[model samples]
Target: MILADTSVWIDHMRRREPELVRQLQTGNVVMHPMVLGELACGNISNRSEHLRDWGLLPRVEEAAHEEVLSLIESRQFMGRGMGFVDMHLLCAAIGHGVQLWTRDVQLRAASVECGVSFTETA
Candidate 1:
């Protein structure tokens, strides 16, 4: 299973690239609540439609606030600014035991440092 990150979703939603379209069409993409929240920040209102289009319901997970906080602190200590959404997504990925699919280099690097599995593409 793969946790589709907001960046890739945004690219798929706005650009409709054939590659992203094909990847998402494969029925392997899943999402967390944080990704839904980010999508909500955009113009999307039909949550069901997005979920259907993405091929999975939100894979809900318990809040790992402490671990997420630790990750944020570590990233800050290492000079990266507070990446709140990225940390939340990472927390969700860790909880779900799935690889995070994101194009954000910093988040990918931080995921490595935190021992979270992640990938740049679907």
Candidate 2:
């Protein structure tokens, strides 16, 4: 399964990204809690519909909080501009053994640096 980040979700909400739509339809995509929270907090017009759609996908089980703190303290991503949520997403993706699908450049870079599988293109 692939863990789709918030950016991809935003794009899908706005324009119906073909690949993401296909993945969602096939149940090949998993949702990250942080990504869900981000979407819920966004100014999305079709909020209820989007939430219901996302609710159907399997959610990535929550990663250890300590792991996220460790990543932050590791300082490997010191200047990468990744915040706690990004690190949390990375940690979850790693823990879940899922490829991360994202459009955020910094998140993609961090994923590469940390050896997490990712797809930047649709």
Candidate 3:
């Protein structure tokens, strides 16, 4: 199982490479609720509709706020607080024990601490 990130969905929508789509076809793929919201927040309604049409299912993960917060305390993220959405995704990936496939640089950089393996498209 893998926690697919919003960046992958954006790639799919843009017809970038279909990596996630291909993975979904053969393996278990999940998306965190925050990921869904992030993807759906800025776009037009039609975009959300298209996502639904594409069978985007909401992924449920135990929200662990403290663990993420502790990570911030432990490691300075260049003296800036981590974004909430990114933090949630990290927590979800850790809780689920799944690798996170994303194009997000911060998430990739923090993969070891977050316990979420990250992969990028070639």
Candidate 4:
């Protein structure tokens, strides 16, 4: 399973990246609430259609809310441009033991720092 960050989803929506599309087709991608919320709040013209498509994907079962607070309290990611949503996504990936696919440099760095598996490709 792969937890794709908001950046990746946004890029995929705009570009229809081949690899990402392939992953989605194969049902290898999983969704996080925060990522979904971010995308929902974006300026996508076909928002309902996009949400419906994403809604078909499985959602991460573990709740990362507390972990997100802990991560913020730890201050480890401080000044690294890591936000609550980023940490939440990282926690979801870590908890699920899934690869985090993202294009955000800061999120990639945080994943490395936290020793979570990640992929920048698609």
Candidate 5:
């Protein structure tokens, strides 16, 4: 199973990348709360439809705030610009033993440093 990141969702919403859309349709994709929140904040017109599609999938519960803050501190020490929501998504992915799919370079690098499994696959 794959834990989808906001980047993939954004790309899918735009219909700019066929591979990403294919993955979403064929892969065992799961959503985290932070991803849903980010999607809700998008400037797209069919926001409700996106949410409905996301809701149909299984969701991974968010990590504890303290755990996310700890991860944030660790990433900061590593000189990574990981944000709270990003860290939360990472923590959820790790806790659930799923590979997070993200296109962000820094996030993928920090995921390696933190031993948080991730993927950059289309």
Candidate 6:
């Protein structure tokens, strides 16, 4: 499983380099709900940009319920609190024991605690 971060997704949606984009084609690609929300949260300057990447979101089976719940309550998110969807995605990746392809700095950092791998590909 792979989590596609907002930064990479936005870059792909806009610049769209064939080689770089291919990284997303083969794997069990996904976007953490937070990553999705972050992209969607962007303003009209690139609303189409956000919408373009929506198709890439992947579907994974449910993860260990507690792993997800603990992650949500973890300090990793600080006072910001984790969203349920994000925890599901993160937990699913961890439960599956696969890497998440992303460029989200925070998510990458959180990857350590989540027990999922994160890869940065150009």
- lDDT of all predictions: 0.68, 0.82, 0.68, 0.80, 0.76, 0.61
Candidate 6, RMSD to the unseen true structure:
4.5
**TM-score on alpha carbons, each prediction:** 0.71, 0.89, 0.76, 0.86, 0.82, 0.56
Error of 5 at 92 (Å): 0.7
Clashing pairs in 6: 3-100
Off by over 4 Å in 6: 17-20, 31-58, 61-67, 74-77, 80-86
lDDT per residue, candidate 4, 13-91, as tens digits? 7887787787788988999888888999889978889899888899996555777787767847767887777888887
Best by lDDT: 2
Query: Which wins on lDDT, candidate 1 or candidate 4?
Result: 4
Write model 1 residue lDDT over 1-122, tens digit each, in one string: 67768888788767775655555577555668777777867876476787565545547464577877875666563356536777888777777777777778777776676566544443
Looking at candidate 3, the ten consecutive residues that score lowest on lDDT are 73-82
Spell out the clash pairs found in candidate 3.
Answer: none
The better-scoring model by lDDT among 1 and 2 is 2
Lowest-lDDT window of 10 residues in candidate 4?
A: 113-122
TM-score of 2: 0.89
- The residue ranges of model 5 lying beyond 4 angstroms of the native Cα positions read 74-79, 115-117, 120-122
- What tens digits encode model 2's per-residue C-alpha lDDT throughout 17-120? 98887777788899887888989999989779988878878999877888888887784776678878888888888888888877888888778776775664
In model 4, the Cα lDDT at residue 20 comes to: 79
Better of 1 and 3 by TM-score: 3
**When superposed on Cα atoms, how far off is each prediction in RMSD?**
3.3, 1.7, 2.9, 2.0, 2.3, 4.5
lDDT measured at residue 19 in model 2 versus the true structure, 0 to 100:
88
Off by over 4 Å in 3: 44-48, 51-58, 75-82, 112-115, 120-122
